[model samples]
Target: MSNRGRDTRTARSRWSLFGPIVAVGTALAVIPLWLDHSGVLMGVAVLGLAFACYAIGFNVIFGSTGQLFLCVGALAGIGGYGGAILADTVGLPVVVSILLATLVSCVTGGLLSLIAVYRSLGVIFTGIITLIFTLTFDALLLGLGSLTGGENGFLIKAGADTFLRKRIPPYYVMLALVVAFLLLHGLLRRSHVGWAWRALRDDELAAELAGIDVARYRVYGALVGAAMLGLAGATYAFTEGRVSPTTFGFAQVDVVVLVMLAFGGIGTLLGPVLGAATFTIVDEILIEFGQLRLVIYGALVLLLFLFLRRGVIPTARDFVAKRRLSQASAAPD
Candidate 1:
């Protein structure tokens, strides 16, 4: 094909990827208009957006490079607590605190990746180490009760007087972040870096042999992903007006994020958002279940692992492909 033909094809390809992004974003944009009358439902929608951010970040690290950093909640906790402490206690600007906290989380995530790479840890081992780190972080929070406010937690006094204190503004803010994250993921998926990630995720040794720096790329993914996670966490602290040990605990955040990523189809863009939205609505419905919510979630995870292991996107894509092949085979010669 001529260069112009190639250019045309590339442009079309780019549109194929980004068109859905714009549509999804536009659809999400109108959500507030629909739920404006109900504060509780709007709040749930915002929480879903937050979980979408978390699942996206995790997808970058684990779905892209197979790092399996299981400290999702712990990392977010760092950002939330750091922002809360700096803005509320240290009297720093809220923006500055959130940025600083994101940096800290980014650095921490990078270091964890480096450790895993240097130690030659496999996915399971990396998860184990990160889980230990998560537990350690929880303990440290309690140990430093004076600062973290211990079991009681502390309110983000700095944000109390801000727009975030209201329901509608925070939803838009979170929606903006989620849309931005989707675009960022799309751009990365179209880049050479994305090729490296796919290669590494498929076969790390082959990727390394092909001149990709596995360690460097993994660290880069972790850094970008962790920064997004931290920013979401920090901003949520201000929006929710509080930070607690339970806020980012493994049971509260990590499990939900993991389930979302799995259900939406790991490694696929928009999977996080789909999964988060689905589960968030389900959660609201199950609110009447009380503690049985966890049991139901556990059952859903089990069913997913047993039946839909490939997740919604991949499974649906495969089904469509198979149907097309069958139709083509059945056509007259």
Candidate 2:
């Protein structure tokens, strides 16, 4: 058998054990509905799913492409505004608004990618550019006070989906999105392009030596990541019944996106999901501090950086993989 085929088979085998585990875990999610405060539990589930989607997109740029773009929240904000404008001002249906918003986000994300790739900006430079873009976008919203309601933010009218209106539907919708994202992640990870991405991420020069178009792959990753974030943002906008420029500013952009990426594990598919959920819950629990929330959040991120540098998901995954390998090696041939 060819070495590539062998590698593929090995990778598949390594992940096979997780299939049943995931299924079981998914089944367990339904148990929350049987509880008394199912409403809040459902809210947690939905929020977890949404943030997971955001994390996956963040990983596409930071994890797969070896690049940094700190405008995740800003891009998501754009998408939210795009949807809101379509629904409110243009009188379009919510579904149509969502579709258009997603398309707009993808186009914007691609444009960013083209510029970044063409300029050959390093990681730090890319972050700076994106950060500036986010700030500028925020300012533009403020200046467009007539349309965006200035600092007041905009809200959406009620819809048929009680789940969305309350929190249950959004949770299920997010859960479905998570499933779709995992499928996409699996497909990408198993493809030749996925290999190219990993190669580029590890060493761009070496990847180029191996015939990978580093710039092209990087652009692809950024677009894909941005598209996901756009989708998530559109959904979040609908769920919250509002969109605000302030929510997508620099503070929310980097700390939440990157911290989730770090706390969950940077490279793995599950990292962002796990990290986002963890951070969300942590933030809620820390909210009683009123003003100390940010301080505690910073400290938590610092602790993760100093100790669990690779993040929890990646570290746990590696440990389990190793243990399974050891067990398999010890088994009778």
Error of 1 at 107 (Å): 0.4
Query: Model 1, poorest ten-residue lDDT window?
Result: 1-10
Best by TM-score: 1
Q: What is the lDDT of every predicted structure here?
A: 0.91, 0.78
Q: How far is candidate 2 from the true structure (C-alpha RMSD, Å)?
A: 3.5
Report the lDDT tens digits of candidate 1 across residue range 205-248.
99999999989889889998898899999988898988899999
Task: List runs of model 2 lying over 4 Å from the truth.
Answer: 1-28, 31-45, 158-163, 320-333
**Per-model TM values vs. the true structure:** 0.96, 0.88
lDDT of 1: 0.91
